[model samples]
Target: MSIWWSLHLRREAASVPLARRLLLGTMETAGVDPDVSYDLSVALSEACANAVEHGGDLHSGGASQAYRVTAYLDGEKCRIEVADSGPGFPAPGPGSAVRRGAVPGAAVPAVTAESGRGLCLIEQLADHVQVSNRPGHGVVVCFDKILKWREGALLRVS
Candidate 1:
């Protein structure tokens, strides 16, 4: 079975949980394992929080105030993407080939740092992660995880 959904949400703190809850509900209904659902939900929350805090230009007065979350469950994998409407990540310097966005093997934030841990946590939870800047637009965080269905899953892939 294949399932997919997308949410266009305002960049607000409350929107984070809303997106997370929707994802959990969808996974629950589709019979995803509770532990797997929980992990993704947490990752989704982090992504949404990032979008809420940094997805807009506070001083620009006209920057978009919305972000997007999209999820896909197909075959044996589930993929989630959170995209924000702020300035994209700065271009990586010549010697920093993979430093633009958070890749799985990239350096993680220091433990005592106050912020910037969301991407690192995402890298840990998802099987594969890719962070990219959309030219002339925002940044996108995309992640995928192999699925493990419950005993009697409704949408289990054979």
Candidate 2:
């Protein structure tokens, strides 16, 4: 049977570490290799940070500014999902204003200066990254990584 784990936390930046810990623990329990575990942890942390910074206005909802993290192991792949509670932004398109070398008119220079590289890093680490708006609420980032199976762990057929 496939194993699934989930966590929900505030969208505050401080909660990023907590989210990473939860993801690491879940991956360890599922027998994920250490290298794969590290990659997943870093990618998830970056995604959470992005959601908190740009997904919506956290102060408007006060303590309600929270995000949800869910992870699961499906055979040789690990799946992770992070959902936030704010109006979502458009998915960054390749060579788009936000991603291109030029700064977009819509983005505030200060915020971009601090954390704009998150999506770029996520793209590098994760095998697949998907972004979508959570109907009526915020945005969801889903990512998947292929797990490397260890040799000799499985019995050979005669």
Candidate 3:
């Protein structure tokens, strides 16, 4: 029995708490352990913050500026995707200076007092993080975590 949940909301600061509650509830309903729930909540909070801050101008009128969150539990793995309607910036490369504390490409500057770090935390928390621009739209951030499922326990069907 797999559990899944999704939400589409306006990109407002007020929506952060709502997103957090949604994730927490989903995690609890999916049988995630308490410790795992804490970790997931932290990761989800960070992701939502990034979306609200850098995703786009949520104050602008229309649906193009909304934020979306989707989550699902598939056996021992949980997947979450957060997307926002904004012009997406290029994420740092695998070995970029941002990752190595060196310098990025010739056009990009070294890590200074202004930027770098969000992705680092996200990488550490989630088993996997994927970022991409939605075609003709905005940006999407996908996160996945592996849950330790106890053996011999039957999954609840809902």
Candidate 4:
């Protein structure tokens, strides 16, 4: 069986934990290995935290700006995607704090003296990570992790 869930959250600090808790609970109930669950949870928190901190023009709409988190589980793999309606990352350059995650083949920048390390951390934790941005819209961070279930039986999705 496959399980999937999505959340539309206000770009607030509290929403980060709420998303983390739900992901943790879902993974736990699905029998995902504790270590793997913890890793993913931390990664998810980082992703959500990035969203909350830089996901959008939080002060522009006065409450309408938001981000989205989606997750999917099937068999031995779980994938999560975090997207926000922010003004995408700043252009990449010599002194730019943003990055080249826009193109699918864009190499994830090496950890340098830059301020943003969220993407680097996500890449290290998840089995695979992909980030893309929509011009004049926002950015999306998608990642997946390998899962080891406690039981070999078919897992059901509630």
| Worst 10-residue lDDT window, candidate 1 | 97-106
* Per-residue lDDT of candidate 3, residues 1-158 (tens digit): 78888889777788888888887777666567766666777777777777778777666667656789888888778888888877666555666553331112312444584544555566778888877765446777788888754333345332
Which has the better lDDT: candidate 1, or candidate 3? 1
Which clashing pairs does model 4 show?
Answer: none
Where is model 4 more than 4 Å wrong at Cα? 62-64, 95-115, 151-158
Tens digit per residue, CA lDDT, model 4, 51-147? 8988777779843378899999887799999998787766556653444442433345555746456777788889988888775678888999988
Model 2: per-residue lDDT, tens digit, 15-48? 8999899877766665667798899999999888
Query: Can you write out model 1's per-residue Cα lDDT over 1-158, one digit (the tens) per residue?
Result: 89999999988789999999999999999999999999999999998998888787756655458899999988889999999879765554555434234643344455697997888788789898888866457778999899899998989989
Backbone clashes in model 4:
0
TM-score ranking, high to low: 1, 4, 3, 2
At residue 30, give the lDDT of candidate 4: 82
Off by over 4 Å in 3: 90-116, 134-136, 149-158
Query: Which has the higher lDDT value, candidate number 3 or candidate number 4?
Result: 4
Clash tally, candidates in order: 0, 0, 0, 0
TM-scores, one per candidate = 0.85, 0.75, 0.76, 0.83
lDDT at position 28, candidate 4: 84
Ranking the candidates on lDDT from highest down gives 1, 4, 2, 3
Indicate the residue-level lDDT of 79 in model 3: 87
lDDT of 4 at 146: 85
How does each model score on lDDT?
0.83, 0.72, 0.70, 0.80
Q: Which candidate is the best by TM-score?
A: 1
